[model samples]
Target chain A: MSSRIDTKTKILDAAEKLFAERGFSETSLRLITSKAEVNLASVNYHFGSKRELIRAVLARYLDLFMPAASNAIAELQQQHPHASLTDIFSALVSPLLTLNSIRAGGTRTFLQLLGRGYIESQGHLRWFITSHYGEHLQSFVTAVQASVPTIPRADIFWRLHFTLGTVVFTMASADALIDIAAADFDEKNNIETVIRKVIPYIASGVAVSA
Target chain B: MSSRIDTKTKILDAAEKLFAERGFSETSLRLITSKAEVNLASVNYHFGSKRELIRAVLARYLDLFMPAASNAIAELQQQHPHASLTDIFSALVSPLLTLNSIRAGGTRTFLQLLGRGYIESQGHLRWFITSHYGEHLQSFVTAVQASVPTIPRADIFWRLHFTLGTVVFTMASADALIDIAAADFDEKNNIETVIRKVIPYIASGVAVSA
Candidate 1:
């Protein structure tokens, strides 16, 4: 990569890590620049403000994540024309589970960041998300509608909203809840276990009638 | 109210509002005191530190919210010796729905704060909540167990955790989603509608088999 691009990538990587670990509000441009080993001028040049920087961070993830999800849906459509609700949900979530496979970034941390974007409307993140990914979200909604033909679109949306809640909340709180489960419930839970557990719960939730 | 008590209430109210709106990390003691019309010394005199102050705010909600939940369970136990899964769910959720009836606080704001408690592990809030509310939580767990006798305790807890994520995530993002639904889907969603929509979804989730 050229120096200019390398500088931008470094800043993005540093921001993503810090935002995930320390949280968006807690992570500062100074911290980000110092970690990235870039100057304030570069940070300003690349992303004008912390708000825009945060949007850029999410946009990076969305760029990677949404394509994988959209492809998953497309593949499901071709392979299983009569896909079940579970299959559609699996397609929606399985790519996220692969975030653990990437070595450079922390999967749970990235998941936490993504979950926070959806759950907490802290900045321009929500608007950035809806406008950018609205069509992709609606496509998933359409996929879900086809799977559960009888369910009302409103019911599907409401349940899907509930499903998003479960995903975001569970992913965001994964590490803490893992420890708490061990300490309080004497049960050990890893990320895979939690996802394995959550999928059916969400599928069942979506399938259940009002 | 006496001056001392008035000062304390003012501090608590301001802290809760700021924390909900700006988040725990983003909201500072200086901002809080200024908003409360109190002084720095008074914040120190009242809550000791921001961590403790956050815990105290949550404890306030638990004081009001838990008893209502516990009482709902008790009433279920008395009223229907054999309450169904939906009944147990209704018992657990109906009290929280009534939190809207009280005018002192915005239900969505309080719910956002509570949801953030579980989603984001800001300071010592997670441990504070688990330790304080563990027994009451276990009681609700047991109530769900009775309703869904076939499900294992571990599965119940995991599902219950998922259920919580759905509740917290949905409630925290209620306002943003309401607008998005209005804008993108041409639908209207409110706090009450969200609650009514959420309960059945949770009940069905908790009852689902692994």
Candidate 2:
């Protein structure tokens, strides 16, 4: 059972990489199996089909990112109890930044898949994200509402949408943007620097006046 | 020559709509030419191949959007002479929001394609954007730097990248995000409302203290 889980994870990791590099349409099951060092039967047994495999790859991200992110935010909510908008926003974003730093490659693939998935709106994957991660987002929205009781509930979601967009886009474009920044401005920018720089912009947006 | 140009625009427009709906890989030349009421020979004559057609579809957008967005920002820069961060940001976003309202379906499809093209980073399309639109973005960066002269140019790029990410993501996820917002918040928010709500958030991010 443990080895099965391990194989599943390895396959997912490989799929994420391929999908990121080649995209959903171009990425083939054989390529994923080859990359993962797993057999086609193993792939079929685990994920059933390419689309399901894509969902599993995406689901793996939520499985890791959502719980960790929500847990951190909940802890922050509990600790401060009267946390400001910045505190709430920080709790939401900092963990992601940390996750990126520690699991850099995985985070990059996840970011790439995220931007692609959302843009592609491939029906099944789209449904998987909304259904699976919807509650996690709602909790953050609730926390945000508590932090800024003045802002309307709808506005909170829109702001969260903006926040996710910023995070996802930055993550997806990380390499290109960093390279351009280095070339144009002669500054050494990395994921950590980007994460740090973006938080304030996002937090300020979350804290914007009605 | 004029009729030829019209036929080309027609094919590009159809390709844009299909690509936005079905994605680049899934969308084929048959689908595009059929939708455009043009023949295969016309498509080949106009753009050489599907990939070139895709490039042409994306190129048409930059041809329109860059000039309009850059001109708006430049005019704002000159008119205000020493505009505030919000003013600079407003000049950048308002034109787009207005364009969204006026064009409605066309803007939405274009936004979808833009997000996809940027994320997919399809080799030719990516090069087209970077080399072609790089100057437009640099001008915006210069205007932003002038507007917020205190902020580091590198930081300005990061912030601007964040802004673009947010805009592109939100635009790409337009229908889905709006649906989620409406379902979660129970308010019937439309594209215009999303645009109006987003500008302030992004503008505040731009206006964020150094």
Candidate 3:
């Protein structure tokens, strides 16, 4: 027999796909349940409502993402206490690339969902961040500040804001970009490639002139 | 006696604001006409359809943006001839920042509209871009390729993709960021501050290793 948690996950998986493709406003609860292959009552039983289910779908991605990111940064700090700003930035960004690369079928869907949250003006994800990920954000910000001491706090904050934008857009728009470029280019799916590409750009931006 | 062009402009302004705040799907033609203080017939008469009106609004911003960007790159090429990658990158980005900064009122609204087009996943903007800006995108991509020779063409394409993402998000989310960082940061109206902060970061990202 399927476990209760399995049913819940199935609902989340289906909802994530629907949300990624159709968006939050357009997607319906009925569609989510049907896609999950569960009865209508199961969704109500598991998530209570569509809004909560949407949160669950997002939380699933964040659950996988936040800890991986935190641990990656922690590991980097432990190993390279005196790492350069480029190293620290790489540490901060690499885990995300790793996570997306390794995850199974729904990883891309979750990324699309996350991208929607960031880009969507509905303010749903902002509320989620304030309530749940505030500490994670602070920790990330602190790591960035510690890594790049030359940048003023305000500038660090602004640059971080911009960095998040870059990351989200790149992940979400990869397919479209590939299409736009006529498939002439293929990005390697490795953390080193991302770091090699993103770190120097951002580091140069933040580094104080001699 | 308001000229027909005045009514056209009024419709564009209203459509831009409504589209920026609510998005293309959520916004309605009725709301746009109401906001523009024009009759419903004005919208259909002027733009043929709501989608076309949205395109018109975007065209105003891009029309200003494309020329300035082109002129900036042209002037830089003429002056430096042997300009470094960073110089060329600055020429490509600075014009957009300058155009984004000097414009007031409706232009700013139109910018927000352009940002929504770039970031939103509904594919509304994709259709618009393919139809309207296909040639301009090729031109910009060609300019970026010329500027950064050391980076592999594939890498350059991906970096430029991320750069556009970052730029669009910066413009779209500036208000939220400014609000969050309000206590410590001085809100500068100067465009140079934006250019200085963003260009180096993007340039370094695209810079060829020595």
Candidate 4:
């Protein structure tokens, strides 16, 4: 990458890591600039303000996620013209599961960022997410409703909510939970195992009647 | 209440509101003390540290939640000696739904605090929650497994993970989602509606097989 692009990437990298660890308000611009090895002026020049910098950090992550998710959904729809609810659901979530596999440390960081976004309410990232991805979520909800006409629309929304919570939590808190429940469970970092384990539970919940 | 006890209560009330609005890190001891109309020395003398003050805020909320949830579960177990999986599921969740009915601002604050704890990570409140509520979760899982024998234990764990995410998100961000979707629907603040809407989706997700 050119020096200009490298600076932008470095700012994003430092911002994402710090945002994930300390959240938006707690993290200082100085910390991000120091970590990125760029002058303070670069952040303001590239992103305008710390708030915009936070938005940029989240946008970079989402830009990577949205295309992959949209393509996976499109491909699945084509492959299974008469796909069951489970099939569509799998398409929607499987891409996220595979995100970690696309690169080293990518999945862990993504999951961490996601969990932080959902759990922390006061961050600028929250506004960015709702504004950018709210429509995408509505689209997913519409597709699921179309696939499973029997399920109530309200229930569909709620199940989607729960499914997200579970996915983000498992990704972010798995290591800690594992430490707490130290039993005969395998210690593998298999993302597939996580996906397979969660999909059914979410599927069953969404499929069941109130 | 005695003057001393009243002052302590005021401090807690202010702290909870501030923490919920600005987060634990961004909200300062000075802000909290001033909001409570107590002196800086009072905060130091009463709570010893800001960290402990945060814990006290959470502990007060959980103290209300834990007993109600436990009682509801106990009542359910007694009422139906052979309750189906759905009944068991309702027993576990219904009490939490009722938490919204607690005094006007209480539920929102509680939800905010819970969301903050889950997302922020590395806190005494998080430790307090997992240690106290971990077994309750495990037992609920066992009931779920017994009811749905076909599902694997690992899958149940994953579904639970999703269920938690959904619940927290809905409780914390429902207003935001409602605002965003205001054109499509009326904004109502009924917690029962939320519970009724969510239960079946989550139940089906957990019960259905892949």
Off by over 4 Å in 4: A1-5, A17-28, A92-103, A121-126, A133-139, A152-154, A178-184, B1-5, B20-26, B92-102, B132-153, B178-183
What range of 10 consecutive residues in model 2 chain B has the weakest lDDT sum?
A: B95-104
Encode model 2's per-residue lDDT on B1-210: one tens digit a residue.
434658888898788878887777678888888888888789899888877787788777667778788899989977898987677766755555555543556566777787766666534565777688898877887887887877776777788879888987887777778887778778787666776788789888977884
What ranking emerges by lDDT with the best candidate at the front?
Answer: 1, 2, 3, 4
User: What is candidate 3's lDDT per residue for B82-134, written digit by digit as tens?
Assistant: 67666766775555555556455443455567666676636677677757667
Clash pairs (backbone) in predicted model 2? none
TM-scores vs. true structure, each candidate: 0.88, 0.86, 0.83, 0.83
Task: For residue B203, give model 3's deviation from the true position in Å.
Answer: 1.5
Q: Which stretches of candidate 1 lie over 4 Å from their true place?
A: A1-5, A97-109, A120-123, A182-189, B1-5, B18-31, B97-106, B181-189
Per-residue lDDT over B22-138 for candidate 1, one digit per residue giving the tens place of the 0 to 100 score: 777678899998888889888889888777788788777787788788888988888898899888877756677676666454567678788776555543666776678888876
User: Which of 1 and 2 is the better model by lDDT?
Assistant: 1
Candidate 1 vs candidate 3, lDDT winner? 1
Separate DockQ for every predicted complex: 0.62, 0.67, 0.49, 0.57
**TM-score, structure 3 vs. true:** 0.83
Each model's lDDT: 0.78, 0.76, 0.69, 0.68
Ranking by TM-score: 1, 2, 4, 3
Question: Runs in model 2 with CA error above 4 Å?
Answer: A1-10, A20-26, A92-104, A123-126, B1-7, B93-104, B122-126, B182-190
